[model samples]
Target: MRRKSVVDTLREIRLLSELDDGEIAVVEKNCRWKTYGASEQIIDQHSDSNDIFFVVSGRVRVVNYSLLGREITFDDLEPGGHFGELAAIDGLPRSASVMALEEARIASLPSDQFQRMILSHPKIALKLMKHLAYLVRTSTLRIMDLSTLGANNRVHADLLSLARKVTKDDMTAVIQPIPVHSDVASRVSTTRETVARVMSDLARKGIVERQKDALVVKDLERLEDMVEDVRGE
Candidate 1:
């Protein structure tokens, strides 16, 4: 077993807020570390998996590759995320392909050991179940947005999704810009130029303020107005 630092491993497990020191040791003792370069495939969808992974740093995109072999990214995993739990727990094939978006470090636990740990520690299983449920609900909402909303409204809903994650205050949500317009377009289901034009318009309207790393929501009410209009149409 290639052991990683326990302290460093714990830092990536913020999603497991209910797990305390004693429980954490069980987790750290089981982990192995690996590094991946940008664009590396971590796991192929439908492939057998005997390892569970926790992101130590950098980003991974969870995507679906269709029969036609096109990749559709559903979510991006940044720091403080854990995946591969589902396949480990259920002994099933991977549900999605994971690809590193940047150079990343990850902690891995053997699937057999993970299953044993979960049975021994009810809290671990409970916390993991809650986390998985939240992902399902969030994904359903994203699919709902794409189905019913206009591109503008989908953008608004997605921004709100980001807002809800940023802070409880809701007034100061940070939506970062993509250096590439095509990236933004994929998220909002619009053209690259359309996302650029609409984002510029929102900035001019004073509903969004651009800062170094984010587009801050200065006025959520004004932003929701755009969503409401889409629902009306």
Candidate 2:
């Protein structure tokens, strides 16, 4: 693959799209670029560094580990997504660690430069504010689920969430390259065994099917009802 130029990579980020060609060039010139191998740690939770990073290639996961050594996954960023802006804006330590899910290229702008850019571009600053608001809303919902839902219900909710994201037509949804059971467990803050058991029951009920490389939700409505029943929604 041809390595993308820093300017081209910056242009790929939606957050920076408001900048014109010349402005993107300026931003690119100030960026520090690096690459990480699969599963490599990109940032440590509570680290003092506050540089904002853009995903130029590949994917990464935003995560943190509990004192008991269990992983909690917050979100995954594919090409064009960015992270670390909260620390940049607040001048605080990182709230979560990030790890590369695959070999990835990342370009970072120091906090000072990031601050200057956003302050100078009102549109960029407004977009960032909106983005942070979305993050807060999502965190609130996840916290509510953790506090109120049982492990089984959380797992069902997680599956339903994924199914909705990729649902096709009215009856079926396919999570291609089926998610790893352990990974799903981490997202829902449950044990791998629980996830596996829930999946097995769903499969037996013909609500879901396992293909050679994907998990097919055969009855999306049934899965939604399962989650709604627990939530009383």
Q: Please provide TM-scores, in order, for all candidate models, with all chains considered together.
A: 0.77, 0.95
lDDT of each residue in 1-233, candidate 2, tens digit only = 66454334588898999999999989888998898999998898967899999998889999989999999999999998999998988898899999999999899999999999999999999999999999999899889899999998999899988988898786899998897999999999999999999999999999999999999999998998999887877
Candidate 2, position 141, lDDT:
84
Residue-level lDDT of model 1, residues 112-161, one tens digit each, is 98888778778778888888899899777677777887776666666656
lDDT of 1 at 81: 87
Question: Which stretch of 10 consecutive residues in model 2 shows the poorest summed lDDT?
Answer: 1-10
In model 1, what lDDT does residue 34 have?
82
Provide the clash count, candidate 2.
Answer: 0
lDDT of 2: 0.91
